[model samples]
Target: MAGSSFDNLPLEWIRAFEAAARMGSFTAAAVETGLTQSAISQRIGHLERRLGTRLFVRQARSIALTVEGDAWLPHVRTALESLRESSEALFGVARDRLTISASTSVIDLWITPRLDRLTQAIGGQITFRTMVLSTDAPHDDDTVRIRYGTGDWPQTYKQPLFSEVMAPVAAPALLHKDEAWQDLPRIAVSGPRPGWTEWCALTGTPTVPIPVLRFDTFASALAAARAGRGVLLASLPLCAADLSSGTLARIGDATLPHHATYWLIASKERLSRTQWGALSGALTLR
Candidate 1:
């Protein structure tokens, strides 16, 4: 058949054919397109007449796509997905709304602190969803993820956000200026983190096993630190505000490089350079 013949056919008929072939039944097509089964059947009949070929083999309780229909399914699906993505991309995805994802600690300490700057820079509203995640958490397509690890995650456009550093911090009242904090209580997170042993090793301090308090989560450990329970070997991003506010003061002069670094990872196909840069700058004043 000529290409002009396709143009002469109603788009409704082609849509009916695609739906019927995909669903494998005229009844299923009718349900999807919000039309009667008979209407769906008539449209598919019209399409086959225009194409001068049978697209499906009708059978009781089931319909099978012909070889040509099977070949065309992928193309139709691609077209629909492309149209949806283009419309969303050009029209600004609910009018410039951005959805981002991060750990509770990062969202609380790092991202939330700069949210006002982000909204002003992008000129759009930003929504944040948080989770307690490790570097091995599954990647999400709907939201940009800030993870902590080396910037080599598979199946993501990974950017190094910041090299993390950890220092021992505590309530100022717990320690005097010249007091030795080496024997003070130690707060540790039992998550996927290098613990006080690692910090002590990096900072050239001998490890002590006394008065060790363990928390299964970072939030609890941080809460303990704020309450003057003990000194916490905490990451800078996780306790940036506490450090800034002087609520938690570094107990010692030793700051050690962390094993896991913060990283921003997302699908490159879903973001443009301008969009990523705007977000990146808002998250980091540097």
Candidate 2:
């Protein structure tokens, strides 16, 4: 037989082959596959015929792969896994578009409020996909990035939104009604400057050795503070909504300068029509 005719072997056939190989029993594969044992056997038979290979050796109670099947299973499995990952990423069900990387603090405390405002400011009706990565600098393909540093940004035109005024805030329930206001664990955010020391220096208050609970972002630290776990130092403007809503309370009036102000940064390329409108409207004095 110079050329044996075989029907078109679909992806389903290949998948069935892989599944049967992995499970080591056609009946078991059928059970996992939600197919009759005969159906699984038929798909594998069709596949082996098309490929002109002996994929498996059947026993009374189990199955064993031929040498070729054993050699090829890894490649087939790898290809299928790669396809699954890529498909999930492209479909948007498991991923997002227009990912905006920023500090967790910015996302939770600041952006959550003004996100609607920012979206409304943009011209088009495009909804953005956002994510938070723990990186100060933006890598390729990031549409917008926010950084907490002195306004000097590389390869970007920087706009200072507003200066942040720092304060030590906590749940009102934590502060004793009768005791003096000095005993609490300080939820210190990791940054260039120690907010507590700077705040104490500014207020001329006796700097006490307040125990520190370190956090990576203002958002997480704020949550801990709100739950009456400890006190957190944060910018009043960023935490304004929580403060006003009485979820968190201003423990004291001491304030300090943010080593870096909040900056809205974008790439130097001409802004898209939608982005131009969003940027202009967001920046406009209201």
Candidate 3:
């Protein structure tokens, strides 16, 4: 076993090791891999023996990776991922239907507006899954994802949808009120986006009153602003239609730019070059 080569290692044993390490539980690994718990344990045991090293420290309720296991886990994951991607790219069935996962705000405000052009360009049917959290992982069947980030995901094809620019906006009726835009009530949205304080700092404006209404999701906040509840710090790209339709008016010329923005990412292994080109070309802002 001391001189055992990787060529002799079984794929099942490697899969078991990877699953157990990622899940930190032999039982959970079994569930994911559709194998019995004892089988997972046996495979991992054989793998450890073959490598002449203890991969995990067994505990009554949980397992923790040994130093050597932790060090090697990343390499193992990368190799397995490469193998899966290559197999899919070279031999997987091609489907005309694509599933995209994204936030409700992005779907309603950004993608929906471009749906017709996108559909015509890709020549496919599209399905949408609304993301509950921005940080949620892509679903197993999702072919594409619209994520809010700086375009730094690894091993995937990604492009920014638009530059991240934000400004204060209010319903036309709200803007017509005698009160100055700065004195109007503010709508606050909770998340990573910069808030009223950051806006004031960037614009060199004085501190404003606290928000009278706050919503956790951007969609809800945008709705409140559309109803003239308050002035909202809105993403210009997402609210472009609102601004164009006279549903919302910009408060001033000042805008805040951000390093992060919405990114359209696709599975490199799942999409062919032509499909990827059409999808990206149709959705990306010029």
Best by lDDT: 3
The candidate scoring highest on TM-score is 3
User: In candidate 2, how many Å is residue 235 off?
Assistant: 1.3
Which pairs of residues have clashing backbones in candidate 2?
none
Ranking by lDDT: 3, 1, 2
Kindly report which residue pairs in candidate 3 clash with one another. none
- Model 3, 83-186: lDDT tens per residue? 87677678777667988888898888888888888888867678988885467654767888888877887635788999999999999998888877888899
Q: Summarize candidate 1's per-residue lDDT along 28-80 as a digit string, tens digits.
A: 89997899999998988888887778888888888899998788778877876
- The clash numbers for all candidates, in the given order, read 0, 0, 0
Residue 106 in candidate 3 has what lDDT?
Answer: 86
After superposition, candidate 3 runs with Cα above 4 Å error = 1-93, 136-138
Considering summed lDDT, which 10 consecutive residues are worst modelled in model 2? 91-100
Assess each prediction's global lDDT (C-alpha) against the native: 0.76, 0.70, 0.86
TM-score to native of every candidate shown: 0.61, 0.57, 0.67
Best of the two (1, 3) by lDDT: 3
Candidate 2, overall lDDT? 0.70
